[model samples]
Target: MQIPVVLLFLGLLTVPGRSQNAATEQNSATDGANAGEVEEEDPFYKSPVNKLAAAVSNFGYDLYRQQSSRTATANVLLSPFSLATALSGLSLGAGERTEDVISRALFYDLLNKAEVHNTYKDLLTSVTGPEKSMKSASRIILEKRLRVKPGFHSQLEKSYKMRLRALSGNTQLDLQEINNWVRQQTKGRIMRFMKDMPTDVSILLAGAAYFKGTWKTKFDTKKTALQDFHLDEDRTVKVSMMSDPKAILRYGFDSELNCKIAQLPLTEGISAMFFLPTKVTQNMTLIEESLTSEFVHDVDKELKTVHAVLSLPKLKLNYEEALDSTIKETRLQSLFTSPDFTKISAKPIKLSHVQHKAILELSEDGERSTPNPGVNAARLTFPIEYHVDRPFLLVLRDDTTGTLLFIGKILDPRSV
Candidate 1:
């Protein structure tokens, strides 16, 4: 059941920071009245978003493992949602074999075919729609000359709400144009992302996300100072450490995973969870292995909010990676070497590269919220000491839909 498909070069990028949605800032000004309208959601346990979330999470972990093996010493970050969204759009033009391959790779086979695409359509609209808390978007780029099937074009535009671009033949101009579009979309947080256009390119699919999440409870900037960040037990570098004595946080220790997990809420529907290894030299292999949709859901269910003196490094990072090996690990092997994308274009095409780049800038923002009188205050006894001074895994998620926006291991924030 081989499907005919084109060669794909998938590139992903992200910029996360302390500021609000830059892409939507202008829109909010023009559409101020509707900006405050609330978004509706189904119950978390019953929603199909959870199913897709699990699939993306598994794919993300698999991809992270591949990248980790290659760059063990460097920081790792990947946006599974971004990659999956792009791939799903590409799948619209795929023939039977190609479609099957993408379906298996993306865990789409587990869901009813009719439900999968439409659910993704809904998810994309909600995440990238008006009144978004973070700035994020994904799209597919094809050579201008290629004749895209009308059905594929209509579905891509209507369902995915993706903007398709035609390469202008001028490599430098096209490169500049691509970078400019990304810059405009991400509100200039990331610029000049593509250095040079690939000469052999037939089709390229990419996704980018930019988020500057403000903590619900702000950290004191005055208390932030340089402190030792352990790269390993033998190595330590000074980094700006942000501390709050009465930081209210959800805390849990996973005995089976052998890691301490803490969750901090962000404004809107987003939340960030950190997994710190008990030993300074310990890496994220175990935690990476344990990441699954149900496991993360269970972790949150088990975690209880507590009073803690939290000390965390002020993180600003930029990371890039290639995803060929990771995609190869999935069921879509033939796609890398030989496959037909006749539906996309009459010309023969094969994938050459799959790459990702991300930038995250996190800091204390806004006035601190006072703790409530009940559970938050009661848990203040002998406050837990959760200092993230070493290598750890951090996940940013949409608490409403249970979607994972970004996941990565911070080996050395000092490097970026």
Candidate 2:
């Protein structure tokens, strides 16, 4: 969901994820609780998020790939294809975040299988943690329901209860326990994430997952001291930053979106493809067009070493959103096909709600080093910025399917 959702059941239903019924109104007392706040920004806003979105968009495209030029009905199905588009467009953000895509995907794939779907009703609550990192990897969390078996009408929902069960109750195991789980997961590289949880409206059939984690290796404190970072047009600013010159995944520019792409390879070839704008928060058109899976592969092949520096501000942000509108904008409303879907309807499934939330924090680790306090008169072969002065994006993906696990853009880091 591009925003959050509140369910006003005709009568309150004590389902999972809620103790008392969530009211159907806004939290006025919490100012900007839904409005976003700015945070430390990267000169470019497309890195982590846009990369994730591109991967997801490509995956969505694969799902809708013409099942066959042979099917005469394929052309008419274009409308519902918007569902995939809508799913991809959301990477710009929904708030209270996680790079959670795998757990949700595994869960979704299970739901698509009747044996699993029928047996796992509370699967959302059944999932937990991912606290322990899988070798060479990252994650994305999402929870939303989807209609299936057209004539049969089926739906499913899954989230982090499994992670909760997996938790030893040690605060360290909690998803939100670490103040900068996100910063660490992304290598002190990503600084701002929206501070809103994915919406909580229940659905008969939905898919969802959340991800928050710390990087296995953090940047050296001495290297993290203030430095001037690059912005578009050769513009630069002095800000705090971090570095991992040894990181397997290095940063560089990609022709796609004329933005830079970061690759974090997971075990067995999987990787997170982070696409970020060079100088500004991207609009729908630029993002919707350029990105492709082959292009990602090409970029991976062409990766070259470069000085990577960033100065992102510490931020606290909050937001509430309803992605229904964003979905429509992305050309996805047709999946609701109460009508066309009726053609495939052996089962009756209707999507009652969809929502999301995300939260993120970025700051300097206690470690420090003596260096140029402000301007760096010394020129080095490579330069990385410390302060985040502009908007940015990130993503998680699977190398095998080239599936985009998660994607989002950080327009206002303070709000994340």
Candidate 3:
């Protein structure tokens, strides 16, 4: 079989939260402080998950920036956390220059050697562990003929909680099995994830994340309507737009970056943030430049809860890309060329292909838009109107763990 490896990162954020009346009291107009609101401290920030999250998101941002440079007029999205987890599993079989390259590329070289894999073990377990909010899984697949080394096998089973699949020579059967696994992992949000099986495949690394959450403040569908989305300064297209007239969310502005930022809550301690340009033609460079882990943490701390009128295009997106150039750009060139995998097999082997696929679907489904029972609405404030009618960057994060679940740029929501 050809060495056609696939890294499928599926992030399914399903909004199914129980309807709750949002706080009707007007928020104080303070910049970073409210009279009695105290920010909750998250323990995961100093944990290995945070470090891993940082490294992975940084890699994803780097890849996004590079891809945007070449395809400046197209949409881009990927789950860096998924890519990192998949690669870390791949690293278990690598040694010598190959291991070093993967380590450096993921910035794992900066972490403690003894703790890295184990930390990943903890991270994976926590993420995929039983939670009402999200579901996640990762796997490494190999052909049945490839003999697994004893030491590698033990570590793989123990630390990674990996479910190994031995592919049979039958192409159709293999495709069905892979698709079944994908469907099971993603809770059926994704079906027929793999179009076809590659005839020449040696190993495949896959990671998936599924999240189902309810908006703390649901968008008023009664107010949602077809709105003009500026694809470019001169071009426009119509798309379903979600709106919340009395929306209350964490808000901030970065004058130096020339962008408006807002954080909307989702059930189970997750949040979706938007980075919108101040001008129609302003590139996302500054916002992209501000994607470091430290920067995000700072934003969370500095932003204040405020009332606002928010509007955004409802997004339904599916993205896939071959990473031949991304891997090289990220300086993991050794893997594509000469590197050691003695731990995995006795025969000389090297990576032949790397690919990623992602999917995102968002809407105000299965939730009530009207207020619960008989809650009375407080007098409205002169809310700042934040409309996302143009290209913007979005980051979905788990507030409890500071984990970035999804990140992407929507150049055109009308384009599937």
RMSD of each: 12.5, 19.8, 11.4
TM-score of model number 2: 0.42
On a 0 to 100 scale, what is the lDDT of residue 357 in model 2? 28
**True-structure Cα RMSD, model 2:** 19.8
lDDT string for model 3 (1-416, tens) is 01112121121111111111101111221312466555443454457767766555556666666666667778877666666777787888898778888876776765676788887777666555655446555567676567778788788877776666767888898779977887787778667556767655566655555454577657767888999998888988999999887666667666656777778777667788888887879988657755755466656765566657778887777776655566666577777567788888887666655556667667765245543444342333455678999999888876755667777888898753
Index of the highest-lDDT prediction: 1
lDDT of 2 by residue, 170-247 (tens): 333333522244454434433432333333322211122233333323446565555554443455555555554434
Cα lDDT for residue 333, candidate 3: 72
The per-prediction tally of clashing pairs is 9, 114, 5
> Where does model 3 exceed 4 Å of error?
1-44, 209-213, 365-382
Give the better candidate number (1 or 2) by lDDT: 1
- lDDT of the candidates, in the order given: 0.70, 0.33, 0.67
lDDT, ranked from best to worst: 1, 3, 2
